[model samples]
Target: MSKQYTPREMLEKLISFNTVSERSNLDLIHFVEDYLAGWGVGSILVPDETGKKASLHARIGPETDGGTVLSAHTDVVPVEGQNWSRDPFTAWEADGRLYGRGSADMKGFAATILAKVPDILKANLRKPVHIALSYDEEVGCFGAGPLVQDILSKGPRPDLVIVGEPTNMKVVTGHKGIAVLKTTIRGHPVHSSQLHRGVSAISAAAKLITWLDGKTAENRAGADPECPFEPPYTTLHSGTITGGQAHNITAQHCEFATDIRLLPEEDAESWIRDYRTFIETDVLPDMLAISQDCRIDVAELAYVPGLQEETDGEAEMLVRRLTGDNARNVVVYATEGGIFQHHGLSTVVCGPGSIDQAHQADEFIELVELDKCASFLDDLLEGMSQIDS
Candidate 1:
């Protein structure tokens, strides 16, 4: 096989398979599996229950014990309405940057890892380098949960997991945890002329919105004394609200989505309970009295924990060293790192490119960034070699 597969070639192979979060990653997984199998490396294919989408966990050395893992999600968010300058599924590079739907968010890192495997294998270092490419990360951190649980169940989980989310190649020690909460409010619709006869769900939703605004304001006002993040403390936001047709109609239904980012001790569940209490006590009492059918319901769309790298985190320190940086940093976006840590693997978020370029039209990862990543991998190899078998 060719040495150091050109970034173009690696990215070409990656972008050919449309591994959108809503779709299957089988083609991409099969390609990687086939490519790795050729080198006598075995892979474990952990398909989702439906046997549609899949996440692959494969080892480069002895699978018996602890090792270093290079993980990246194979899924990309949908490119539905975005006006792309070119085909989003086809890899194209211009002015030293590769463009595609997942180029920076982040098939580039996955491709880079696969490209680096040859060099890692050739090094014959004491520690094994494992690859964990997952699916459905864009939708939520869903696919990785079960796959990692299986790994932990067998014991001796990987020593560290590097989640390659875009961070301009910086070693990210922390990010906010996210909870996607949806709330639906129900009431009765009647003629606008008979406004008194109708209970408006849109109006109820306004009450819920006010409640959320209060939470956001409280956080904004008294963000934190013990906050560990930038502009830290929990925040609540309602993104979309829809109901009511014509001005004449009293809207009967309103559904809105609210997302919250909580501090570790804040306990998102407790906040959810508090929000439920507000609805049960303040918002719903009047509506329920008029009609027993009126209600407000909340459900979780997804939940992923925050990444908090230890002060002396081995994984964070290693990544910072590998990147040739003297200091580690933090990011605002959540990633798959915390989940890996939750499942017993010391993990940090580090990868090539910038999130600024991620999920944007004509998303791209610059060639310079890919070059820096290759150099980091080289540094990682040298660093790993220092440890005795």
Candidate 2:
């Protein structure tokens, strides 16, 4: 018989694996694959090109259509700069909370699903329950696209996908989309005394960053008061910036990264086009005037589509019925739920823990949150068993 673990134990085991976004998650993936195999559940591994990382998916119960997909990502953010009291990868319980990296962000919910496997098997579900553990979700949701394709190609279409993304167990019907971009400016280097003769890459970068901030201010000013999002507006932000060799010299190179979060109703391409146009028409011309080699380049790092609210979405109704949470909610962060919904699968974001605790120094999920998530899964298993296929 496969060893049965409580949700807490599963969480501890998962936390032990340092599946940071920058590192390979294969060790954690292999562990999960073996655990699922112990339960006689076979997993399909979708490995990335490097073969160092992979996403795992498995089905419990009948291999029929209209199943529910419990989706969670295995990767967590880096803990390098955080002031953690203990090892971020070591799970510890204190003050009714489970502390560790990835605890609240997602691993808590993933642990709950794994711990419930025995009950899921016993439920003899009429409808299948799909478990989808994805990789690279923190950095860019890069793994989810391929995982979703693999799942849809292999089996009958899933009826709904519930993305466990630390929503305090509340059902989230929509979230903002994100477009990650990197901008690099190349300029002719010259002494600051002769600044007028050569373009300063750093100065150009500052102008572009100011433009991005201005765009954000414009959106904030025009934000919809009735919008469910906290800020209720699109946002543009520059997370990192690097360039300039010295104070006395006009910089030869400047580089920065920015991300734009758009409402589900907005078009991402339009924003990209607008930003590119600003660089080419408004910014780049001045640099080229100084030197023919002077240029600005903008590259897209990643793009995650927003989760749009579905009218009477089945996923929403099912989650509300299970958790009895009727409050309509939307989040500002992006999730793989958007990708699932984009591929014609009805999806919602609902999971244990608060997003506030995610990506923090002492990240934790309240013990009660884990219990509530377990109960939610229990209710789902019972319902799946009782419902007709």
lDDT for each residue of candidate 2 in 1-389, tens digit (9 for 90 to 100): 67899999999999999999999999999999999999999999999999999999999988789889999999999999889999999999999999999999999999999999989988978889999999999999999999999999999778999999999999899999999999999988999999999889999999999999999999999989999997899999999999989999999999999999989988888988999899889989888887999998899999999999999999999999998899889989999999999999999999999999999998999999999999999999888886545
- Residue 180: error of model 1 in Å? 0.4
lDDT of 1 by residue, 302-326 (tens): 8888777576777877887777666
Query: Given candidate 2, what's the lDDT at residue 331?
Result: 89
* Candidate 2 off by > 4 Å: 387-389
Which candidate has the highest TM-score of all?
2
RMSD of each: 2.2, 1.5
Clashing pairs in 1: none
Q: Look at candidate 2 and give me any clashing residue pairs.
A: none
Scored against the true structure, residue 69 in model 2 reaches a CA lDDT of 98
Instruction: Give stretches of model 1 more than 4 Å off.
Output: 1-4, 225-228, 386-389
